[model samples]
Target: MKKVTSDTEQQSLFWLIKTNSGRLSEADIQNFKIWLKASDDNHKAFRKASLLWRTLAYAPTLSEQPKLLEPEKKLRKKRQINSWYAVAASLVICMFITLMPELEQPTAPSEAEIVSTLELRTAKDEIRQFTLLDGSKVWLGAGSRLLVKLGSSSRHTQLLIGEAMFDINPNPQLPFYVQAGDADIKVLGTIFEVQKRNSGILVKVAKGKVRVAAQNQYRYLEMNESIHFEKNKVLPLPSKINPESFAQWRSKRFHFVNTQLKDVLHKLNRYYKSIIYIDDPSLGDIPITAAFQLNQLEQLLNSLSSIHNFSWHKDVYGNIHIKTNESEISF
Candidate 1:
C-alpha cells in the first residue's frame, strides 16, 4: 500500500470507514464530533476522504479474470494485475477494502451504482445557490447547512440547520423529499421555503403543493399556505400568507408581520457583527411588525424602542442590550 503522507487525511479516512460501518456507539459519535470540530482542516480532509471512498465503492469491477497468455502477453497481464493490486492495497489502507460486515454486499452491478451526495453550507453573512444533478434548484440562506443525496429513484435533502428555498423540477416518477428537523416535507414539484427555528420548523409554499408529515399526522399545503411544527407535532391548521412577501429575505430585505422579537433577533444575529441581547426573557415574546434591509438593523431597533417603551444601550464589548425603561438591572 502506498504511504499516506498527510496524517489528517489518514485519520479522516479511518473515521469515515468507522462511521459507515454502522456500529458507532453514542460515545463514539461524540468523540467524532469533537474531532470534527477541532479544526477546519480536519473537516475538509474528512469530506475529501468520504467522497473518494464513496466513488471507489460504487465503481464497476472486472467480471472475469483474463486467461493464461503467450510470453509476450504475460508482461501486459502482469501490469494489469499489478494495477488491480495497487487499487486493492489503497482501499485496504483506508480500512474499507470491502463492504463492512454489517452491510449487505450488492450482488448486481445496478445495485452497486453510487448515489451522488453533496454538502452545501453558507457563511454567517453569505447566501448561496445550488443546482442539483436532477435540475432542481436550492437557495441556502446565511449560516445554513444542507446535505443532498440524489439517487436513480428519488431526490432527498436534509436541512441540518437554518433556512433554504427550493424550486423543484417536476418529476412524478422521481419524488422529492426534504427532512427538516422532525418534519418530512414531500413534493412532486414545487417552490417553497423552509426555515428551521429554535422553537420549530416553518414551511411556506409559494407554488404547487406539498405534504408535510410529522408526529404521525400530515397536512397538505397549497400555494400561499404555510405551517409551523413545534417539537415534531403538527399545527392544527395552515395559515394564509403572501408568498412574495414571505420570501423577501432572498433579496436582502426582510418582511415580518407579528413576528416575535426573539425570532427577529435570532435571524438578524446571522448578519450582525455583534450580539443583540434582550435583558428580560419576557420581552422576547413581544410581537413586532417591521420591514427593512439587512443593513438597517440598528435603525429598526431604535425605532422600535420608542414605540415599545424599551431602551437599548451598547456594552463595552460592543454587544447591544435591550431592556424595558422601568427595569434597572445590569448584565
Candidate 2:
C-alpha cells in the first residue's frame, strides 16, 4: 500500500517482470517461490509490482477514456488502496525513465556495425562476381562455397568447398585472408586464385605476393607463382603459368599448360557437374595443353581423342568414360 522507492523494491519489481513475462524456467520458478515466501512483505511487494506491470498495458486505454480519472477520486478516499495503485504506476514510470535514454541514444558502432558473415554458393556452370565492403573484388567459380567474414580491421573469406579468385584492393593497414582447409593465404593487395580439391589446397598468385601457411609450413609466393599443399609440405609449383588464362573461370573458359589429363578433368568437372572417368589409369598421366570454353566440353573431349588415341563413350549410368584404343595405343 506504500510508495515503492527503495532500490530493493525496484530490483524486486524488475526480477518479477523478467521471470513472469513467459513460462518460468525451473531455476527461476524455484527462486521466485523462495523469494516470495521469504516474508509477507515480499509477497505484498510482488503482487503490487505485478499489478503495476499489468496496468502499464492500460495506459493507452486510460488515455483514450479520460473519464476514468473521475473514478480515481472515489478510490483515493481509501488512502491504503489509493497509494498502492499510485506506487504501481510510479514504479512503471521510474522504469521507463531509466530506459528511455538507452532507447533514444544512437548505438555504438561496434554494436551497430556488427561483424556479420555472408555465404555465397554457385551452382554448376554458374559463376558469381561481386565486390566487398572493402572494395576487394571476388569471383566464385562453379560448384563453389564461399563464406565471407568482414571485420573493421581485416577481411576474411573461407573457400569451404570450391575455387575462388580474389582481386583485393590495396590496404596495407588491413590484411586479407582466404582460408582453405588448414592453409591460410594472407595478402595485402593481390590477385590470387585458391582451389581446394581432393589432392590438396592449391594457391596461385597472379599479381602481388601471397603468404601461404599450412600445417606450420609457410611460404611466400610472388606474382605468376603457385604452391600446392600436400599434407604438411608446401610444394612450390614451378610449372609454366599462363597469366592471361588466370581467373578465366570467371568467363566460363579455362586454359591449360601441359596440365595432366586427370587434373584437367578434375577442374572441368567442377563446371560441368558430370563424371568423366578414365578407364585406363595411364591416360590420367597424359599431358594436355589447350584452351576450351566450359560449354564446349563435348567438342573438347572429341578433339582430345583425335590426337590422344583415346575413345570416349557415355555408359548406361550416364558417365563419360575414356580409354586407350588398342589400334592406336602406342607401344
Candidate 3:
C-alpha cells in the first residue's frame, strides 16, 4: 500500500480513524465540524474515506484457505491484483492504508469485553438518534450533548446538557445509569426521558421502572411517572404523566403544560437560530400551557403576546423582543 501524501487526504483519514475509535470529545467534534466546513475538497475527501470505510466494514473474511484448479487459481490471483490496484487508486483520493492491518481481517468485538466512550451532540434545530454498543437506543433533542460510556460491567450515560430519551436494552447483570446534573437515574431495563432545565433536572419514565436519586434521597418510579429535582432539594412525590408526550420534540411538536415563559423560550431557542428576549422580567414567570408544531414558533409567540397583553418585535438582526403592552387591556 502506498503512503498517503496529500494534506487533505491525510487530515480526512485522521478524522475518520479518530471518529471511529469510539472516544471523541466535544472539542474534537467541534474542530472536525470546522474542518469539514472549511472547503468542498475536505468534504469530498471525508465522504470518500467514509465510503471506503463502509465498504471495508462489509467486506467478507475467510475462515480457511480453499483449494482451486491451476486456471482458477491464476484467475483469482489476477482479480486480486486488479482489486488491489483499484483500492490503491481510491486511496490516492482518500487515504486509508493506515488502517490496512485492521481492515485485512476485521473481527467483531466480544460483547462481554467491549469498552467504549464517546460524546454525542446535536446542533441547533437538529435532532439525532443513536444506538449504543450494548444495543440500547437513544434519541437526542436539539442542541443537546450526551456522554456515553459502555463497559462490560455497566453502561453509563451523562446528559451534560439538553434532553434525551433512552430505550435501554435488558441487561440485569449490567445496570444502566444516567447522570443529569445532580440527579442520578438507575435502571435495569426501561424506557425513559431526562431533561436539564434552568430550574433543575426532570426524569420521566415511559416503560418499566427506574430509581432516581438526588439531594441525598432516592425514589422509585414506574411507567407513566415523572419527577423533578431542584439543586438542593427534591420536589414532591412522583406524579402521573402522559407517556405519549415523552420526547415529543422527535415528532416536531412540543407540549408545554404550565411551563414557565422563560423555559418555553429556552426550548424554542434550541430550534430557532435567533435569540428570544423578554424585556419585562415579570413576563418570564408567566405559566404557559400549549402545544405547537416546532415550525410555528412565531405564531405561538404572537398568540402568547395577544393573550398576555404583551407586544413583540423582531430586530434587524433577527432577534425577537417581547415587552409589556402600554395600552389598556379590554379583557
Candidate 4:
C-alpha cells in the first residue's frame, strides 16, 4: 500500500468523488471519459478517488476511526457504482498509510450481497447509534439489540431485548410506540430509558412524559420519575428520582438509593455474571444505599461485607460466590 504524502493529493482525491458524473458538464464528462478510456490504471485511479470521496460522505466516523473507511458490506444494490467507490477508496486510502501510518484496511466481506436489513446489531463491546427506517433515532446501549421498521407501512418500535435509551423522533402523523413486556409505552417525541429486568420492566422518563399502560392498568409517569411495573400493577407514585445517581451507568458505575438488596444484586448479576447466593432471605429485604464503579467485582463484595456478615469467594474468571453462613445477621 503506497502512502498519500501530502494533503493536496488527499483533497484532489476528495474532489474527484465530490464531483460526481451527473455534476459535470456533458463536454467535460466526455473529455474525462476519454481520459478514463486511455489506460486501465487510469480508470483504476479515478475509481479509487471516487470511492474514497463517497466513503467519507457516508460514514464520517472514518475521520476519527479512519480504519473503518473500507466498505465491508458487499456492493450489490448499485453494483457498478458501489464497486467503483470501494476500489477508489482503497487507492487514495492506501496513500495515508505513511504519514498517518497506523491505518490498515479491514478484511473485505466474503462476498458482495447488497446487505440491507432494518435489524440493528453491534460488535461485542462496541456501542452504536443509527436512525431506523422510521424517523426514530435510537441510542443502543452496549450489547443491546434493536428491531425496527419504517416506510408507508407506518412507523412502529419494539424493544426486542436488552436495554436501550431512545430519543424518539415524533410524528403525530405516525405515533411511535415501544412494547416492553405486556406494557406498551406511547410517546410522541420524548427521551426515555426502558430496561427489561428479569421479573417485569423498569421505565424512566427524562424529558417528556410517557404514557405507560400495562396489564389492564395505566399511569402517566412524569419527568424526573422512575417506575417499576410488577405483579400486574405500576408501583405506587414513584418517589422523586435522583438524576445524578442514575447517571452512574454512563460512567460504568452502579448507583443505588435505598434500592432493595435483592434488586441491587440482580443488576450486578446481569452486568457481571457471578454466581450470587443470598442464603439469608432477610438480606434480600435489607435496603442498600451506595454508589460503586463496577470496574472491580470485589469492590462490590467488600461493600456488602461492611454492613453484613456475608461470605464471598471468587474465581479467576470473575465468577462471584456470595452466601451467608448464619440464618440471620447478628447486629
Candidate 5:
C-alpha cells in the first residue's frame, strides 16, 4: 500500500481485471502469466487494489439503492408490476451492499466524470452486487461486464458483454432495460437473467414477465418463462421449463432439463471454474435431463459414464476433459 503505481497503470489493470481476468484470451493470459512471474509485488498489489476497489464501490450502492436479488436466485417473484415493486423495497432493508473504509473512490475531477454513466466490470474471482439509481439490483457474474447510460427520464443498462441477473423496480415512466449482444430485455418492472453464450443470448425470466422480441415479431413469457433470442429470431424458450436451477449457480447446484450434454458442460465450466471437453459434436446434442451438484463432480461423471461408458480425464488444475471410444471429445 505504501508504493504507488502510476494512475494509468492502475486504470489499465482495473479494466483488465474487470473485462478479462478469468476469461482472458489465450495470448493475453500467456502475457499475464509472464507478467505475474516478472515481479513478486505484482500479485500482492493486484489483490490489494482489487479488494479495495470492490469494497469502496459499494458505498454508493448501500446509501443509494435497494437490494433486489433473490437469495440463491430462489426468488418467489410476482407477476403484477405493483407486487414486484413491493418485494424490491423489502430487500433494500436487508442492505447487503456496504462500503469498507479502505476503498474511497477517486473523487470526480470534472463534471464530465460525474455523469450518471456506470462502467461495470468484474475480475477473475470477483463476485459483486451493484445497486442502481432506480432501485434495480444487479449481480455481476464473475468475469462479466456492463455499462449504463442514465438520463433524466430513462434508465438504460447495457451488457457490453458477459452474464448478469436483474431484479428491477418497474418504473413504467423510466423503462428499466438491458441490452445483451444485439437483443434487449425491456420491462417496466421484472426479474430476469441473461447470458452471452457462444451459441446465442440465453434469456430467462423469473418473475413478472419479459418481452423477447426482435424485428417485428415479439414473444412474451409469463412468470417462470424464458426464451433464447438470436439472429433476430425468437425461438421457443430454450427448454420447456424454468431453468432456475441453473440460475442460482452460487448455491453449487447446476440444473438442466433436456439440456444437451455439451451445453450442460459449458455451464459447469462457467460456474464450477472447471475446463471441460466433449469428445464428439454429437455428444453435445445428447440430452441430459438431470440436476447436479457441483461438489458431486465424480457422481456426475459416474452417472454420465454409465450412460455411455465414457472415460473422463482430469488434470492437476481441476479441469476435466473427456475422450474415448464412447466419448467423442469436443471442448
Candidate 6:
C-alpha cells in the first residue's frame, strides 16, 4: 500500500464519523470494511483521524473555546467557511476510493488486534446514546467523555470524565471492560453504570456480576449491588440499590439516598453545565436525600435550600454560588 496523502487522511476522518453516526445499515458496515481493506494507508489515515476526532471532542469541555488560538488569517477564513471548515474536502475522494479495489486485503478482523480508540462526548446540557459495532449500548450523561476501544477478542471503554451506563451484549469469549477513575470493571454480560467523581468512582450493577478492581483490591458485585471506592478503600459492603431506580437518569430523573451534597452537585453539574460552588466548606459534608426532574434546576435548588438553609444565587456569568444563610449578606 502506498502512503496516504494529507487529503486522503482528511477523507478517512470524514468516513469515520459518518459510519459511526448510528445511521449505518448492515450493508454500509460491510462496504466500509471493504473500503478499509483496500489499502494499508487507509487504516493509518483512519487512526490519525481518530486521534484528531478525540481531541476535538474534548475541546468543548474546557472553559475557554479554542478559537482564540488560531492565526488571524485562518480565523478570518473560518468565517468564510472554506479553510478550517474544509473537512468536507475528502468526502468525494473517499466516495471514489470506495469504488476502487486496486489495493491489498485489509487487516483481518479476527486475527488482528486493532487498538484504535473512538471517543463519544456530550456537551454541557446534552445526553447521548451510542451503539458500538459489537452491539453494545452506552448512555452517556451530559458533559461526559467516553473512549471505546474494541479489540479482536474484547470490548473496552474508558470514562475520561462524568458518567455512563453500559448495556453490554453477552459474549463469554470476549468479556467487556470499563475503566472509571481509579477503578476497572469487568463483566461478561450485564447492565451497569459507572460514575467518576472527584472523591472516587462508583459502580452499580443492574444485571450480571461485575468484577471491580482498584489499587490492588478486587471485589465482585451482583445485581442490585453498588459500591464506591476511594483509592484502595471500598465502602464497607455492597449496598442494595434497585437497578431500575438507579437507571432513572436515562429519563432525566435522579435519586439520591443519603448521598453527600458535593457528590450530588457533581452529578447535577454533569447534566446542567452550571458552575455550582459551595461558599461554605461545611456545606460540602451535608448529606442529601433528594429526587429531581430534568430541566427543573431552579425548583431543585429551591427545595434543597428550603431544608438546608443555604441560599443560592446566580451570577451574571450564569454560575450558581451557594452559601449558608448565616454567610449571606446584603449585596
> Which is better, 3 or 5, measured by TM-score?
3
Q: Pairs clashing in candidate 2?
A: none
- Model 1 lDDT on a 0 to 1 scale: 0.75
RMSD of each: 17.3, 19.6, 19.3, 24.1, 24.4, 21.4
Best-to-worst TM-score order: 3, 1, 6, 5, 2, 4
Pick by lDDT: which candidate is best?
A: 3
- lDDT tens digits, residues 258-293, model 2? 778998888777777677888798999889988888
> What range of 10 consecutive residues in model 4 has the weakest lDDT sum?
101-110
Runs off by more than 4 Å, candidate 3: 1-114, 326-331
lDDT of each: 0.75, 0.70, 0.76, 0.58, 0.59, 0.71
Q: Write the per-residue lDDT of candidate 3 for residues 1-331, one digit (tens) a residue.
A: 6543565676677678768878886656755776677689989999998887776544233323244547678667666755775576566434454533212211223566559988999999889999988889999999999998787777788899889999999987777888888777887447988989887888888899887766434556788998886787533467898767777888778888788999989988887788888878889999999998977878988888788978888888888888789843221
Descending-lDDT candidate ranking: 3, 1, 6, 2, 5, 4
For all candidates, what are the clash counts?
A: 0, 0, 0, 6, 9, 1
TM-score of each: 0.60, 0.54, 0.61, 0.53, 0.55, 0.60
Residue-level lDDT for 263 in candidate 4: 76
Residue 111's lDDT within candidate 6 is 30
Task: Tell me the tens digit of each residue's lDDT in model 5 across 157-226.
Answer: 6786567888887776565667777665666337778877655787777777765544323344566666
Off by over 4 Å in 5: 1-114, 124-126, 160-162, 232-246, 278-285, 325-331
Minimal lDDT window, size 10, model 1: 100-109
User: In terms of TM-score, which candidate is strongest?
Assistant: 3
Q: Report model 3's TM-score to 2 decimal places.
A: 0.61
RMSD of 1: 17.3
True-structure Cα RMSD, model 6: 21.4
Question: Residue 116 in candidate 2 has what lDDT?
Answer: 59
lDDT of 4 by residue, 1-331 (tens): 7545333343234336335535665434454454456557656666775665556544322334434334653233345555655666666554443443211121212224212236676443344678765545676644556666453423445676556677877666555567767767767347887876655777887877776655433445667887776655433445468766443454557766677878777766545544455656777877788877767657767877777777666656655556675543322
The 10-residue segment with the lowest total lDDT in model 3: 100-109
